[model samples]
Target: MKTLNDLLQLGDPRLYEVCEPVQENELPMVKEWVADLHNVMEEIRAKYKFGRGIAAPQLGIMKRLIYLNLNTPSGSVPYIIINPVFENLSEELFELWDDCMSFPNLLVKVKRHQSLTIKYLDENWQPKVWKVEGAISELLQHEFDHLEGILCTMRAIDNQSFKWRPTPDSN
Candidate 1:
C-alpha cells in the first residue's frame, strides 16, 4: 500500500501540473488512490499533529482527487472528493495561515472566500455539492488549488506573508 513516506516537497515540477479529471469507469483505480490518501493523511495528521485534508498531487499522483478525514464528536468521517470545483464563492474573504502536505514546514498567510459551494463526484460516482466555511473551507480551497497547479505560496498576500513554521527543536 502506498504511504506518506514519499510526499513531494516544493520545487518539484510535477506539483505544478494540473491533474486530469477522474472518470466513472476509473473508480476501481481511483479507489486505491483514495485508500492511499486516507492512510497517508491519517498518518501525517498523527505524526505532524496537523493536516485535515490532502490532494493527490501531494503524493505524486496528478489526479483531481482529495481525501478529507474529519474528526467530529461522533467519530472520524472520511471523504473522497473527485473532480471538485467551486460553484460559487462569497464576495467576502478571510485571511488565515495555510499549509500543504507538499510544503509541510511553511505557512502562507492567504486570503480565501468566506463561504463557498462546490460540486464534485463522490467515490460512488454520485454527484454532490457542499457548502463550506471556516477552516474546512480554506482546507478545501487549498487542496483544490493543487488540482490546478496553484499552491498556497502562490496566493500569499505578499512576500511578507510567507512565513515558515518554526521547527520544534528551534525553540
Candidate 2:
C-alpha cells in the first residue's frame, strides 16, 4: 500500500476518467484503497494544517471514493465514503472560492449549494447517510465533481475571475 506521500496529485489523466462501479468481488480492493487513502490523508494533514478531505482521483485512482477529516476541537478522524450519492441539494446556491490539488495553487469561485444530504457506504460496507452544510458541503461537492470528470476550473465564474493562493506552508 502506498503512503500518502506516494499518492499522485491531480492533472494526471487518470483523475479525469469515470470510475467503474464497485462490485461484490472487488470489496477487498476497495478496502485496501480506503486504507491507503486514509494513510494519504494522514500524511497530508501532518504536513499541512487544513487538509480536511481528499478524493480518489486526487490519489490517481479513477474511483468514486473520498476521505474527509473535518478539523474539530475534539480531534478529527477520517471518513471514507464510497460511491457516494448526494440528495436534497438546494437550488439556492452560494459561490465559494475553491482550489484543487490537481490544479494546485489556483483558486476559483464556483457555485455550490449551501447544504446537501449524502448517501454512501462506510468502510464496513454498511449504508450510511449524512447531512452536511457550510464549507464541508462545498468540499464534498468539489470532490464529487472529480468523479464525473469535472473540475472547478470549468465552472469558474469567468476567466481571470479567480485568484491563486499557495498552500499553507509554501514559501
Candidate 3:
C-alpha cells in the first residue's frame, strides 16, 4: 500500500455524487485500499495528534467506506466500516467544529446528531452493528457524509464564516 494525499478541495466535482458499490470479488482490493488508508491515517495522527478517523474518499477513492481509530488509554484499534448504513439516528442535533482531510485546513461548524446507530460489514465480512456518541458519533457521521458526497463545509451553520489554515507540514 502507498501513501495517499488528501483529497481535492471543495467544488471539485469528484467531491459530489454517489460512489459506486464495491463488489464481492473486489473485497480484496477494498482491503488493500483500507490498508493504504490506515497507513495514511497513522501518518496524519502522528503529525496532527488529533485526527481519529479518515474515509477512503479522502484518499480519492470514491467508495462507501471509512476507517476510524478512536484513541484509547491502551492504544488505537482500527475500525473499518464498508458500505455502511445509518439507523436509529436521534432527532436531537448538536453542532461540532469539523475538519476534513479532503478539504484540509478548513474548520466548519456543522450540525449533527447526538447519537447514531450504524450497520456495516467488518474486515471478515461479518455484519456488525454499533451505536456511537459524542465525538466518535460525530466522526462517523462526517465520514459517512463523504460516502454520500457531502462535505462538512456544505453544512456549515454560519455559511462562509469559517476559517481555513494551512495544514502543518502540508506538502
Best by TM-score: 1
Q: Name the 10 consecutive residues with the lowest summed lDDT in model 1.
A: 162-171
Judged by lDDT against the true structure, how good is candidate 3?
Answer: 0.80
Local accuracy of candidate 2 as per-residue lDDT tens digits, 38-152: 7777776565544667788777777788878776889976788888999999787898788775555568988899999999987678899999988889999988988887878
Provide the overall lDDT of each model, using Cα atoms, as 2-decimal numbers.
Answer: 0.87, 0.77, 0.80
Model 1, residue 41: distance off in Å is 1.2
Candidate 1 global lDDT: 0.87
Candidate number with the higher TM-score (1 or 3): 1
Candidate 1's displacement at residue 114, Å, is 0.5
Residue ranges of candidate 3 with Cα displaced over 4 Å: 4-6, 165-171
At residue 46, give the lDDT of candidate 2. Answer: 69
Summed over model 3, clashes come to: 0
Candidate 1 C-alpha lDDT tens digits along 1-171: 778787888999988999999877889998889888888887777776787888999888888999988889999888899999896798989999887877777899999998899899998999999998887888898899999999988999998998777775687
Better of 1 and 2 by lDDT: 1
The residue pairs that clash in candidate 3, if any, are none
TM-score of each: 0.94, 0.85, 0.88
lDDT of 3 at 146: 82
